[model samples]
Target: MNIQPLFDYIRNHVTLTSEEETFLASKVSYRKYLKGQFVVQQGDVCKYESFVISGCTKTYYVDTEGQEHIVMFSVEEWWTADLGSFITQTPADYNIQCIENTELIMISSDDIEELYIKIPKLERFFRRVIERALAASQKRIIRSFSMSAKDRFLYFREKYPQIEQRIPQYMIASYLGITKEFLSKIKSQIILEQ
Candidate 1:
C-alpha cells in the first residue's frame, strides 16, 4: 500500500532525509478493517498506534451501564489510538472501531521508540501531534461546560465539518452528550432559524 500520504504528513511537521523516510517506511505496516471491526478494544492492551489512510473510525467507551459514549471520530488523514494505553502499555479503556471500512498505517509502540533514535526529528513531530491532541481534548472539555447543547452541536459541525453525514445521528449525539431525540430537535430548531 502507498504510504506517501504519511510521508507527506510527516514532511509538513519535520524535515526527513530520504534515508530516514525509507527507514521509517520499513518500520510501519498497513492494515485494513471492515466496518464494525475494532482496532483496539476496551480492556485489551493497545499495541499499535494507527494513522488513518482511508475511511473512518470511532473512538468510544462503554460504561458500566453498557452505554457507549463516543469520544471522537477519525477520518482520512487523521490519527486514532488509545493514547494512554499506547503510551503506558496498559489495557485500553476505549474501543476504536471502524465506522466505514478503514485502512491505516500502523506502528508498534516499540517501533516508535526505535524511530525516535534513528530519526530524532520524528520525536519533535510526534510531540507536536500529541500536544495538539491534548489541546483539542482540553478545548472540548471546556466547550462542554461552557457551550449550550445547541451551540455544542453547531461547534461540532464547524470543527468536524461534513462529519454529520458520515456517521449515525446517535453517535453524533453521544459525542455531543445529548440524546438523539434532543439532537433531532436541535437540528429542527436550527433549520427553522435558518
Candidate 2:
C-alpha cells in the first residue's frame, strides 16, 4: 500500500528531512482490526496513536444503561486516539472501535515522543492536529446545543456524506444524540423534500 498520501499530509503540515521521514516510518507499525473489535477500550490506557488506512472506526462511550454514544468517526486518512488518556497515561473514558474491517498505522506514545526529538517538526505537526481537533470538538458542542436534530443530520450529511453508507443508522442516531426512530423519520422527510 502507498504511504505517500500519509507522508504528503504530514509534509504539508510540517517540514521534514529525508532521514526524519525514514525514522518516523520505521517507528510506525501496521495493524488490522476486524469489525466489532476494539482498538482501545474504556478503562484501558491508550498506548498508541493510530492513522486509519482504510475502512471506518468510531470513538464512543458506553453509558450506565449500556447505550453507546459516539464521539467521533474516523475514515481513511483520519487519525483516532484517546488524546487525554494517551498524554496523561490514565485509563480512557471512551473506547475506539473498528466499525468495519480496518487497516491502521500506529505509533506508541513513547515512540512518538522519540519522533519529536529526532524530527522536531513533528511536534509542530501534532500540535496543529490537536488544535484542529479541539476546534472541531468545540464547534460540534456548539452545534449540539444550538441546532435542531434535522439540522444536525443535514450538517452531518454535508460534512461526511459517505458516512451514511458506511455507518449503521443506529450508530448515526447515537452520534447525533437522537433516537433511531427519529433519525429514520428525518431521513424519510429529507428524501421526500429532495
Best by TM-score: 1
Each candidate's lDDT (Cα)? Answer: 0.95, 0.91
Where is the poorest 10-residue window by lDDT in model 1? Answer: 156-165
- lDDT, model 1, position 164: 80
For candidate 2, give the lDDT: 0.91
Native-to-model Cα distance after best TM-score fit, residue 148 in candidate 2, in Å: 0.1
- Tens-place lDDT digits, model 1, residues 4-49: 9899998888999999999999999999999999999999999998
The candidate that achieves the highest lDDT relative to the unseen native structure = 1
For each candidate in turn, give its C-alpha RMSD to the true structure in angstroms.
0.6, 1.2
**After superposing candidate 1, which stretches have Cα over 4 Å from the reference?**
none
